[model samples]
Target: MNTKFGCCLIIGSFVPQTEGKDMETDKVKQLQAGLQLLEENGYDFAELTVQFLTQLSEEEFQQAKKIIQQSSLNIPVCNSFIPPQLKVVGPTVSIIELDDYLDLAMRRVREIGGEQIIFGSGGARTIPVGFSKKQGYEQIKQFLCRCESYAVKYGITIAIEPLNKLESNIINTVEEAISLAEEVNLPHIKVLADSYHMDLENESFTILKRAIKDEWLSHVHISDRERRFPGEVEGKEAMNFSKLFLILQEANYRGLISSECNAASLVDENALSLQFVKRTWSTVEGGIANVKPD
Candidate 1:
């Protein structure tokens, strides 16, 4: 399997994470800066949030797509597909409005060569108070199907990302994501296994094995327990990519595994974090090479 790697541009930053302060850079400059750092650090592609497309108008989106096309590296997958401030499962949700937004987003994402769009906007999907669980589930299903309509037209797949409970009330596990995809029964709908969310939920690699066997896994998001880059935190808190990579390699998985995490700072040490991820993967791949074919 040609297991490629990428990092999320929206969540990853050159500046340290801080509260009450959002770092805003134009998409062109952001892509230029991130692609340079990631390419130097041995990354294969860059991931951007669909928020960048949603934030722009028709003309602006065209220009943004141009910028992405001109980037030194490919933006293969765009995460955070939903509009940031829009809710999909609440009394306040306007499904019609959201549907329109999804259509526009899919068109732009298709133009920009993003094959997969990650649906992991915790803020957008969280069921608000007073909404029963049943209502929330039905609403989310409908919302995803609507997105799939656009996806089919624009030639893209939607990877349903299961966030931890703190971030999302629905679809918090690989099983749940699979169930949702099965229920929706859309060819363009798929599942993503995010390591941080899986760890927070106390879910096991066993589920990932199941997902792989069923071919439900479309993409992967890897990070340490604290949402820092994988392999950065060592000792007791280390992210065990060894077993996960073995599962992926044994299954012959060929999909994008992205670093949707933050670094302490994106200075010189950022390259080290990216290298740590590559080295860990290389070690696991080496182990796989020693295993005799059954």
Candidate 2:
């Protein structure tokens, strides 16, 4: 695949594995169902949450791994890297805890053949009240530096995800993500572009073009304006996925693109969304105009 297309397996809202055995079993079953749907619908991979795998017990972790290993689709990408309790920033941050979390998270992701992990833990990275944005920025940069070491050790790439202001205080745009990733200056650390967040911020897709040009983009996430599945809307309310794919085509972006959104039905919604994206992509060609946010 020139540009791999996939979707985040939201399944059920992630419940901590410690919550209960029934919930744990439900999650595993949901994973099995979701993976089957993705493979059946022709998805290239499935995006899972890093927190889910990291929190699993040894046996549960092995079970989850087995489920993924048996699937036709690869779990090449994961999001929700750090949980809110981990504290990637702020004065209360603990280096020891962060290190331990990163060690386990990186190892687990690599074990499942994950190539990139999206760092979009808004709560974990948010600047606390009275905390200096400057300091928080530095803290995040330092955190990414720590992550780079783990990435190198595990042979996985870390994609710095830029959330919208409502979702995060820092790194609210692709430009900011690119700058941070550049300053970090590690081969294992790269940037990601999320269309939903970009629309929320009204950021121009032209910046994604720049990200592609500068080789800062490592992965992408797509959703409509309301955080609905990519194909949920059309015409005026629709996200111009064709333009987005055209940008990728023009720039020769060979990275992964996953839809991260909400939907009423996992099977129906994902299959429809997958078909919509594939249909739109099939019709796109070069010479399209720059994407200006509506």
Candidate 3:
């Protein structure tokens, strides 16, 4: 399998060096820092959180794109975080109004020359706290279909990410995400597997390996057990990554594997996390290389 490395820009990586004054300026600085880190680590791509990108003005967004372009990196994926309010069905049915948002988001991706949009499954309150499993499945299917329509227009793919139960009750497992993608019946809509959420859900790596189809597995988010730098966790690390890498190889997955996790408290520890990812990816590549020809 071809192993690719990427990172997600969030609080720690992107927030500027201000003691905590104007959040906007701080965010730009943080993003700039993140770009530098990606360059230093030799990451091939970077995925920006939608929350941060949405806050940027056109010029700011262009500036970010220019910086990234000038770097030794390529911005291939942009994951949009659907705010909690937008997902709920309250007075603001923003969740239902995804068409416009998707159009704008896709346009931005095109403007910045990105390939995929990672869609967060609906938020906690979008469905009733005690909503039936069937109802949840149907709502997700509908949402994915809507996203698919927008994706088709811009030649961009939509990757559905299943958060852990703590983050979201709906679509909390790779199985759930796969089921929804299948139900949506759109070639452009695919599943995204994040290691952090998988750990939270206590899902077995084998299950994810078997569940992801070659075409449906669109993206990957890499993080350790504690959502920290990779080496911080121990035990069967190689085994877990080996399973995923082998499966991806068999499935012929060519998407980006992004390091998506909180790094705020680990600001000083960024290099460690970045190094860990590179090393882990090297291990994965080595394993793939050793696979004997049938």
Q: Model-by-model lDDT, in order?
A: 0.79, 0.86, 0.68
The alpha-carbon root-mean-square deviation between model 3 and the true structure, to one decimal in Å, is 3.9
RMSD to true structure for each model, in Å: 3.8, 3.6, 3.9
The sequence of per-residue lDDT tens digits that candidate 2 reaches over residues 1-294 is: 366789898643334445667777777788888899889898988999887787677888899999999999999999988888789889999999999999999999999999889999998999998999999999999998899899889999999999999988899999999999889899999999999988888888888788998899999999988778878787797988888888788787878889998746566688888888887876674234444558
Query: Which predicted model would earn the best lDDT?
Result: 2
Runs of candidate 3 with Cα error greater than 4 angstroms are 11-22, 88-97, 121-126, 130-133, 211-214, 235-239, 250-252, 265-267, 287-294
For model 1, residues 234-277, the per-residue Cα lDDT tens digits are 88779788888878877878888988876445554567777787
Clashes of 2: 0
Clashes of each: 0, 0, 3
Better candidate by lDDT, 1 or 3: 1
- Higher-lDDT candidate of 1 and 2: 2
Candidate 1, residue 206: the lDDT equals: 77
